[model samples]
Target: MALDARHWVAPAWGPPEQWRLVETIVPDPGPGEVTIRVRAAGMNPADRKHVAAPRPGVSLPVPIGYEVSGEIVAIGPDTRIGSGEAEVGVEAIAFRVQGGYATALTLAAEKAFRKPAPLSHAQAANLLLAGTTAAEMLERVHARSGDTLLLHGASGAVGVMVLQLAALRGVRVIGTTSEAGSERVRRFGGIPVAYGAGLAERVRALDLPVRAALDAVGTDEAVDVSLALVADRSRIVTIAAPGRAAEHGFLSIAGSQPASAALRDGIRGELVRLADEGLLTVPLSRTYPLTDAREATRFLAREHPGGKLALIP
Candidate 1:
């Protein structure tokens, strides 16, 4: 059955000011692809960055969302699951190479994973990008039990996941967050220190020897404090600053750039396992229907980088 699809598109590059919701016809799944009826789609920082500039290799009038949770509604040849499974966190981030912001999307069969039943549509939607980033960064640094990890932006979705997961691995995680989020950080088994001015002093006051740092925040203070404390530049990874991170002598994980399928799945599986073990969590600040995407994006930016913003279809 053909279904109507609603999608967000930007005819030109700029702010979300260019966003327009249009109705389009559902396309058939091609060979090795299955169409997903997107129940929820999670937003990411890449959405804003990509929208700011039009580039070569990007399809025009394309839809834009990275993480998704949905059901298989149509299948191409040689597939197993046809429909009706509320597969959680079916990622289409690389689908960003194609697109994901639509009521329905055709994804390579190998790219879709069954969402665990323990997660809600929003929870599943929130898992893919942030969760995957956290897991990957931890592994990159070889963070381990009994190690003390200094985390930047520990209250945000990615930061929270990294904090908790590190703790679960027996690593002592010290983190930077606002006073408002202190309880949440503490609950995640991390010691929360305020992010600005004197952050290094506050962190060192925690009385733990730092082994490494993960800068998910991209703040100058994060770089300064982490570098001063950690000593080993190789163990410091920054998710935000691909250009300057290496210049500043730290490792970088450019989520805005291409990541390997193996790298993607490594974090995906670990995040799912963490959720199953009750070790992973996300702060979903709000959800908006697809029609209200502009408002969703604006609210997301102002919510001070905590939790997640999700679009429900």
Candidate 2:
């Protein structure tokens, strides 16, 4: 059976203003595929920035989202998800799939996993990208129990995950945030240090020996402070500061990079397990209607929003 769906697409490389919502038919799952009735779609910077301009090997009319949480409405023969055989009516989450900002979609079964009962659809939709990225950052720095990890942008989506994950590993986190965001860091078991002029001095005043640094904010101040506080450049990692990483000899990781992608893919199940156990949680600041995607992206780009954002269909 064919299902009708509405989805957002960027017909040309430009800004969110250029995106359009169009209706299409979602076909039944082919071999190794499953059809999802989307409950919520995860929003991330990459959902917008990746197609903002023409890039090599990318085609136009690109789908706008990469992750979602939904229910399996149909399953193809030979299809299997991480939880075992795919079945209709089971709640599930999928990541790294195209055209997620839709009422429904059909994607490869491997991209879908059973949703953890502890997380709502909105929270599940927003999980893997930030969770996997946070896990990889911790691994890159070899963060372990008894080590102090300096986390920049500590109150944002990835930063909050880092704080929580570091806590699980028994790693002490001194997270950088704005004055308004301090309590969020503290709530997640991080020592909040405000970022700005004299930022390095503020951290120095903490008097704890910094073991490694993780940068979520790609600012010069963040880079300079990490360099000043941490003696081992290899122990410092950045998701936002690739240029700075190249210039300063520090490490950088992105989902587009082969090594980073492999590491994230390998650990998706572990992160889900953590969420299932209630040790990890996604803090949703707000959710927007599916049609309000453009407005939501604009808000995400311009404001902090204090936590993860999602689009409900």
Candidate 3:
């Protein structure tokens, strides 16, 4: 069957202003792939960063978007989920898909998982990347039950996931956030501490031993506090600041980092189970129509919504 779809594309590496929405033919799924009718797509900072400076080897006119939640419309040959047949019309969430900012797209069957019934399409769309990142960082730091860790930017998307997942593992969390976000941090079972001047002193005042630290904010202050509190440099990881890793001797797990891939691929099914069981929750800040993507990017750039932002396709 032939399919046509509308999608946003970046004509070249530049600014978000350069992206244009246009019509194109949607390719059929190849072997081991399935076609999805996208309902919602999650937006991330990387979306704009990639547009501003395209990744190496990616040419112009690249489609934008990384994660989406939708329904299976067609399945390709040799596609099977866990030794079973693929089911059409089943809602699923897929991440790491190329060109997810479309009305429909084809994805490897293994890369998609059934969406939890409790989560809205917008929430499911935003789940995978942040969840996987959290899983990897926790693994990097060797986080375990009875451990206490400091998490910077704890109210943000990835941070929230880390906080909740840590809570599930019985690990205590001391989370840093703005005054406005403190309540949210607390809601996720983190000990909320306000960020900014005297932040290190405030964490010190807690008088609790910090076994490891994860920086999601990439701020100089966050880095300094983590360094001061966590004695082992190897236990300190930053998802936001890869360049600073060399100077500080801490681990960095940015996009495409080898240390992160295994956990990301291995943890998706578990994350789905956790979300389905009510142990993991993704908050939706707002949803914008796909056409308002530019506006959505602008809002994300300027505001700290403390939750996920999504685009309805």
User: Highest lDDT, which number?
Assistant: 2
Ranking by TM-score: 2, 3, 1
**lDDT tens digits, residue span 159-269, model 2:** 999999999999999999999999999999999999989999999999999999999989999999999999999999999989999999999999999999999989888
Best by TM-score: 2
lDDT by residue (tens digit), candidate 3, 1-313: 8589998999978888889999988778888888889999988988888879857888889899999999999888868742246688988889888888889988788888888788999999999989999998999999999999999999999999999999989999999988889899999899999998999899889998999999998989899889999999999999988778789899999658665776788888899999988889899899999999989998999999778999998
**Residue pairs in collision within model 3:** none
Candidate 3 weakest lDDT stretch, 10 residues: 77-86
Q: What local distance difference test score does each model get?
A: 0.75, 0.94, 0.89
Question: Across residues 188-270, which tens digit of lDDT does each residue of candidate 1 receive?
Answer: 89988888888888887888899999988787888888789988888999887566687777888855456634686656655
lDDT of 2: 0.94
Q: What is the C-alpha RMSD of each candidate to the true structure, in Å?
A: 3.2, 0.9, 1.3
Off by over 4 Å in 1: 80-98, 256-261
TM-score, candidate 3, is: 0.97
Q: Order the candidate numbers by lDDT, best to worst.
A: 2, 3, 1
Q: Which stretches of candidate 3 lie over 4 Å from their true place?
A: 82-84
For candidate 3, what is the lDDT? 0.89
Candidates in order, TM-scores: namely: 0.90, 0.98, 0.97
